[model samples]
Target: MYYSREVAHQIEKLRKGFPVISVIGPRQSGKTTFLQHYFKHYSYFNLENPQTRDLIEQDPQQFITLNPKNIIIDEVQRLPDLLSYIQVHVDKQQEMGSIVISGSQNLLISEKISQSLAGRAAYQNIFPFSLSELQMHGLALPGHLDQMLKGFYPAVYTREIEPNEFYNQYIVTYVDRDARLIKNIQNLSQFQKFMRLLAGRVGQIVNISSLANDTGVAPNTAEDWISILEASYIVYRLHPYYKNIGKRLIKSPKVYFYDTGLLCALLNVVEPQELATHFLIGGIFENFIISEFKKELSARGLPVPLYFYRDQQGREIDLIFESKTKLIPVEIKSSSTFNRTFFDAFTYWRKNIQAEISGYVIYSGLDSQKVGEDNLLAWNKLDTLIDHL
Candidate 1:
């Protein structure tokens, strides 16, 4: 059974305008299944097959002849050299939706696309699964601990698989495999340590030197590993929202994992209830809220950027969603109790900022109400807030 994906709408629209449409994301984000399901009318080719890959890499002419036009190429990053030939055929034919390519790594596909395909292809990134889509899949309103530990991955919900075992294999299959594919690593154990430590730092500002020291690797290796993780969609770094706020600011970006399940796997919590008393519960909650907001924006084709607010005086806001006219500030809390203090940061910003801004507090509480200038939202009501924002 296939649940719906919001990115399908964006891809359908892009197919009409561009000759090539590419979807790039982390492994198991359903890039291959989603595209194949949508474009069943098009010829299918899997470059991961040795025979097909050999033809494409060793004999480009024969590969081109075999795949004439209107084809869907799976794992095209496995053989990016074929993109030049694709570019030529699309230009000569001048047909919209002549080729659709899906790859797990953004590093190779994006660079090759710009160098070869240029204006001929349109691209978008697909995340694991959004809360809204999970709801559509008949999942219940998960407890705070359950949500954090289980995450929003599609396979976990669809197949009813154990999240712990699934994420364990996920790390071995994608994280370890991708690192080997990217660079020559003398120690696989050290590389795994780098990822585990990085996951421990989710929702916190990154320190490359500290990470390297603890992982027993050099700073340059840590930097390169961070790039590889981002390129493969395993992590995202949220830039600080900086403006003249009458205080000096820290520009170091906060790191967040794409799926909380994978982060928890590295953290080694076996059960969902463990998240309740876990040391990083608050950080995990913050990560979940921010990632949920990201999926909403990506689904609607919104290009707005997300930012975090922190000042030299120690004041902070968890998320800042910016648009052309108004800036929306959101504070995330793991406690189910609704507290007035959550509005402190938003209230301060409302008074200081001279432009249009809206304030919101999203907590695990069941009650939803309006305070003086800000609105308090229950966790389950997040989908409605996405509509308004």
Candidate 2:
């Protein structure tokens, strides 16, 4: 029942050149499963086990002695001290494909790697399953609207368990273990409240002071918590796209959760049926699609420069992909019925930006069509558009 991931080949390519490769992502995003399936030949260690932790802590040299090349270390952040030792060992052995590390907390692992294994490691972020990966597994591609509500988490898509129970456990585990392990925040209740508040603000320009006011925390504290979330790969921030466009662009970045299931769970959305009638349904859809597009780009080892375009004249596009030479504008709608009025913002983008590339209106529809030279595509076709881009 395991579905192949797009990052598998990238990991293979990385092993050929780098002695150490680190796969980082949020907890339960399938990092351990991916490494275990792909790197089965390598000896594995899970540092979460007290025996393994004690062994590494008591005698670091012995830990290295046990790893006789071609080793995969799970939860490597638990043993950050061992990274320097591994760096030295790999340099001396002059070996490639000998060390692989996977951790759920990117905040801790990336810091250690930067300080200890800088320029000696290849890093990759493993998000939950994307639309392309789901299609590759022969699963019926859920329409964009359904994908938004159901989310693309590995467990959710596989239907391995009840969505409600799975999401409930995910939130508890995330708050209890993942958040605490990475950052020293003693206020678990406050953190939980902040997460829920963040869910309500999805896909909007983030106002730190307003969030601070709502959460009853200092502005600086709110900013710090957001950074911790972003660093841990739980959330993504989309900056505004402006190239001296002669307008006062919004400076604050918009934040979106990496997976909609987590977002929905935080918002207490127990079912897709519940989400369909919820007030935040549209925002949830926007958040889901944008995050999926971001994941697709990362899976292909490409930089995701996503932004939203807005002008002082009250015209805006929901999402914009900043390419090498052109700005690709897109609008996401929750309705399945196509209408000509949906292209208004897109027309504004074309007329004002003067970009030749046609814009897109992504909706909850089955058929892909063209409306006055603009592409009107369904949500499931996102992968195809990305490939053709």
TM-score of 1: 0.95
Q: Provide the overall lDDT of each model, using Cα atoms, as 2-decimal numbers.
A: 0.83, 0.82
Candidate 1 ranges beyond 4 A from true positions: 244-250
Encode model 2's per-residue lDDT on 1-389: one tens digit a residue. Answer: 67789988788888888888999887777888888888888888899998988888898877887784888898988889999888888888768878898888777889899998887899988988887787777764454545555666677766678665787788777778877876778888899899899989998888899999999999999998998888778797887778854332447778999988788878988766788888988888888789889888888887757888766675778898877777788899878798999888766666667757788888877779878868898877887568656
Model 2 vs. true fold: TM: 0.94
lDDT of 2: 0.82
Q: Give the local distance difference test score of model 1.
A: 0.83
Query: lDDT by residue for model 1 over 252-332, one digit each (tens)?
Result: 788898888888999998786787788888888889888888877887778888989877787888988887777889999
Candidate 2, after superposition: displacement of residue 291 in Å? 1.0
